[model samples]
Target: MIMPRKGGKEAHDEMHKANPNLKVIFMSGYTADAIHESFGLIARVPFLSKPFGPSSLARKVREVLDTQ
Candidate 1:
């Protein structure tokens, strides 16, 4: 589950609680202050800041997916 700040984090949180096995990869184009305002602590999730290159994006996705 990939949840950016644009969509409500509550939805993700609720879904996450229901299925704790889910691995959420969050992305954000907003600044730190904006991200804090938009979202609370994303429980058991990896956060990926935007403007990332292909290697970082691919590596992260692979790292998460490979573990599963």
Candidate 2:
């Protein structure tokens, strides 16, 4: 059981304000649709569902890194 001091979007927003070029890949146990509805985030944001293996993570990182 893990506890977070701040929400992922809040932390990301703060970091993004400091660095506009920062790329993010959100990882959560919840589904993408659920996250979008709850967080009010756009569909363009990258996301990774939980239980992903190294390969999937690597691919997602590469994809985000390659995005404009």
Top-lDDT structure, candidate number: 2
Tens digits of lDDT, candidate 2, 1-68: 11378888888889999999999998899998998878887999999989899999999999999889
CA lDDT of every candidate? 0.68, 0.88
Q: How do the residues 1-68 of candidate 1 rate in per-residue lDDT, one tens digit apiece? A: 23465364777668779998777667777654566556765344556778788999888888888776
> Model 2: clashing residue pairs?
none
TM-score of 1: 0.59
Instruction: For candidate 1, give the lDDT of residue 27.
Output: 74
Candidate 2 global lDDT:
0.88
Candidate 1 has an lDDT of: 0.68
